[model samples]
Target: MAVKDRDRFSTTTRIRLLGEQTAARVYRSQTRRQARRSRLTSRAALLALVLCTLIVALAYPIRQYVSQRAEMADMVRQKERARQRVEQLRDLKARWQDDAYAEQQIRKRLHYVMPGETGYVVIDPDAARQSRADQGAADRPWYSNVWDGVDKSDASDQ
Candidate 1:
């Protein structure tokens, strides 16, 4: 009976030890997994921080680069316009250098004719009448017109 009691006690003690070992193994594995998860979370957080910082730091320079490119495009357009204007002026200058063009301009603007040429003056009667009606102090002598303007300014002041 004493031997049987000893075997029973030893068997019970071994079972208890086995249960405790299993519980300890499960706790250790859980802690290790939690540690791995924390490390991963920290790494992800750092990566996100780095990305945010990069975006903030690059934002202003990127914006400035885009704006400068737009400004450069505008400047190029203005330069093209100026070049066209220069080309037009050069063509006009070249035209004016020709004696025939100069003569034509003089004839058209100043109503000039060569000595042997008979020039006919065409008049619009209505336009002539309107001009005559519109003529006032300006048609008078310069001295009289000046005095008339002075008189008008004086009257307005009064």
Candidate 2:
């Protein structure tokens, strides 16, 4: 009877100790999980920092690269335009080299005619009248016009 009482007491004590140990293990595991979560937050912060740093470091260079590419394209367009201008000038030079074209340009610009050809000028009467009205006394002979200008200036001075 004393042995049975001793066995029962020991078994109850063992069960109580086991339960305490299991609770301690669960508490330790929860603490470890919280520590791991904190560590993950720090690591995430570091990753975000690195990403922001990369963006700051690379932004100016990326912008410059894009702008330089645009400038290069503009230079290419200017080169093409210069090439077209050169071609146009060469064509104009070729046209000017011809005697017939030169003569036509002279006749059109200077109103000249070939020798022994009668060239008639068609004048607009309204334009002629306007010009005559605007001529005043200066359309006369040079001496008369000068005398008239001198007389006018003398009269103004008096």
Candidate 3:
């Protein structure tokens, strides 16, 4: 036999080694890409979750703000009505403080007979019947009804 070349490897062994190295590299690269993709997907999901939480948390406060604004508007309207009523009452008070106006109101309401002047009351039959039936608020004192009428008329002056 010829002398053996111990340093020389077989061609099949070199080819097999190269194929195994390539397979390992491919597997590692695929694993790295999958890991990166999964990481990105997780981050996106977390961002979405945070956004949903923020929306949910602010919903009640937003509703409360809208309702409070409506209530504030109603209160402002009520205040305006009250202010107008106050101004009307002030004007009526000034008018009633006059002697002639007070005497005229008393004469009209009470059907009082002045000196040498005749006073006659013309009552509606239906109203008289209703008053007799207690349907009218005549159980109260006449002055109370008059004062209430004065107050109501003052309010309507606005």
Top model by TM-score, which number? 2
Alpha carbon deviation, residue 50, candidate 3 (Å):
1.3
Compared with the true structure, all predictions reach lDDT values of 0.85, 0.85, 0.82
- Global Cα RMSD, each model: 7.5, 8.1, 10.9
TM-score of 1: 0.56
Sliding window of 10 residues with minimal summed lDDT for model 3: 1-10
lDDT tens digits, residue span 58-77, model 3: 99999999999999999999
Please say which candidate is ahead in TM-score: 1 or 2: 2
Model 1 bad stretches (over 4 Å) = 1-30, 116-158
lDDT of 3 at 146: 77
Error of 2 at 18 (Å): 11
In model 3, the runs with Cα more than 4 Å from the true position are 1-40, 125-131, 134-158
Model 1: lDDT equals 0.85
Tens-place lDDT per residue, model 2, 1-158, is 89877766897877987899999999999999999999999999999999999999999999999999999999999999999999999999999999999999877656678999997667677657775336656343345466767888999999
Cα lDDT, model 1, residue 58: 100
Mind sharing the TM-score for model 3? 0.54
